[model samples]
Target: MMQHLIRFRVFLFAALMLVLTAPAAQSLAQIASPYDVRLAYVWQNTVTLADGDGVPLEQTGPSFAFGQGARLVWTADGSRLYIALDNGLYETGGQGGPAVQVPGIFGRTLTFTHDTGVLYYLETTAPQDEEPGIVSFPLREANTALMSGGTGKLAGYFGRFASGTTRANLTFAAALYARDGGLLGPGRPTLWPSYGSNLFGTCCFPDPGLGIFTLGTESYSVWDATFMPGAAATNTTQTYLAGPTTNGVIRIIDLITGGTRDYAIQIAGGLGTIERVAWSPDDTMLYFISRYNPTTPLMLNVETRFPVDTSSADVTLYRLNLVTSTIEQLAWRADVYGISSLAATNEYVFATVVDSNAALINAFNTQQVAASLPSSDALLAPYMPQTHLWRVAVDGSSVADVRDDVWGLAARPIR
Candidate 1:
């Protein structure tokens, strides 16, 4: 209503460094995804449906637990189901029903708008102004009350949206600690020049306006995000995307040639932080999820296996190729160090790894016996990694698992 209360106070100060660093015990060895949990795990239970390499599709599919907000999104064509429990956001179908509850939508990083079912959550009503309110709901059926100026037409469309009568606009390569970050397609609000992280109290995921961004450092808490898919109408920028950009820093906005392309991420083991991206409904490839912070020195003085070493990380899944711009490396899970979630379907590219290698290789070997323990709290070794659900092949060729205790994977969009 006043542009959603000024888009909820500029998404409450660009999500005040991610709602004041929400880590109520999440860091399960850095599992940052399942496409960042947007698919909501679809009412989980260990679903492992694979094909495209790591063969194992729908092995019952369901198994989740990560605190009040257990998601499972779906709706664009797969029927219906928008689960986000902790007692809020619910709706079901696709082979099950009566879960209702979509009124007033609750917290979590939900997103949708492809064919326009309109939903964009992150609300806490009024938690003593700890700031949290950016709601938008509409699944039809006389369930109204998501009005924020009639023509946002579902901000930046996410899954399958490109048939056009004027589309292709979402802008923002800016980052002075982001604000209004960048409005997704439709009109006005295209500001730039806020290059790279410098945030203060991060809780996460904000810097999504299609030209990707997920930059986080909190002085070295390290996280390099940058996502894609904002109603991509192919051409006008680089239809088909990926992130965590670094080949020469970033900036690539061109809403139909408003112009701006500093591009230079020619890739190699130097690209970091574009943790997830998807495309290939003929937009020409671009299945991604790169991330880094490696120090590999395995055995005899081990470097990183997360026995309490600050920047422990690793994750890969590449396939660029916007017509030969080339970049392929299909799958590589170094026993999972981090990667919360990712999903991109045209032919599969879903992920949810957080491996933590049996909770950081143990039996007097973790941190190599906690460096002969003497109590740094026993040299710290509190492992908690377990969340798998992979599927690869956007042309990089198969990489299966399909589902092995998954609590993240919501890919059934396409409109």
Candidate 2:
């Protein structure tokens, strides 16, 4: 009888443990990782964030007016959304609350430090023709109306000298400022030297191990730049990498060691120029769009439509293997439009297209490239007749989904 009782006790204990652990395991399976990508969008004035499944997670106010040149910046906690426009800054909490206008901006790209919660903004008071500078505001004071009332020049320009001119006759060189107005280093100006040229777009990734990745325009090249840990000075070394530019090739300089590398892409039929370069989430591969004769006339001879091979106008997405220095064409569909502004996550890549009456978001997965070629249903979805921001997983499982009715789209891993 005691042996039977012991057996029953052991069985009961085993059953009890299984019952206790099953719910926790199922709960974990259902809880998505924070790193799992969710997209945010702004329609009219309201902003919303949606999960990979296209389900609405959160939505903000309808009073938040985002006109031209408006961009969204999610707070470090992902609980607040900061909408930066050419006029001012508007902020809305995550739970679809009322968006309040924060006073200090007069048209600049704002950068927020995830570490200190300090807000930095580039301030340029120079005439449209003169050199520009940058400035910063403490996070606590950022909400004030007169946050940038004082002209604090974080960096200044050193005039460029002409061949026959004295120092007095030299023109002030154009200046470029960090998106966030933080002191770059301990130089006399406390700012990094900027050539003052504008580039297509800016991407800022703050790394706890590596300092930061600042690319676009006169800032830094993606192919080069050895980012050091906890250091402000980029190594002067550089390498020249061949790029797909109008000239067929452009120099890629490594900001760190100042080393240069030469890279060339063999485009069939004719040489093409690169429209944009997008990096994978893991930085293992690079996706670039190249077009042949982009300026070729699309409509010819006033009335009659030109029988043109629009397929040639199609932007080809090529995956570059950074390790082997090899390039492969992934997709070549003529129906997709505006292939320039493409964003990639771990699961998929999203590209926007325009048809006769509506805009469509197309998705391509890295893993299922062979299967997705020629026709992609995710790309040919129920199109919306309006403009909006769309995102997709790079992995290909999650379909393309719309985020908001915003123009420019920017995303970073939620570390």
Question: Which structure among the candidates has the greatest TM-score?
Answer: 2
- Candidate 2, residues 318-366, lDDT tens digits: the string is 6776667777776643432233244455555544332222121111222
- Give the C-alpha miss distance for residue 25 in model 1, angstroms: 16
Estimated TM-score for each candidate: 0.27, 0.49
Model 1: lowest-lDDT 10 consecutive positions: 170-179
Q: After superposition, how far is residue 126 of candidate 1 from its true place, in Å?
A: 56
For each candidate, the alpha-carbon lDDT, in order, equals 0.38, 0.34
Evaluated at residue 311, the lDDT of candidate 1 is 26
**Candidate 1, 1-415: lDDT as tens digits:** 0121112111112223233233222111221322212233422332323323333322222232222124455554555556554344556554442355655534333434433244443222221221243222211111125643232222221111112211121111111001111121121111111223221111221323332222231122222223232211222122212332323333333332334443455675566665555555454555666666554522333433323322235667877665666677787766344554566666667776645433334533644455444212223323323355677766657677765544345554432
The TM-score of predicted model 1 comes to 0.27
Error of 1 at 384 (Å): 3.1
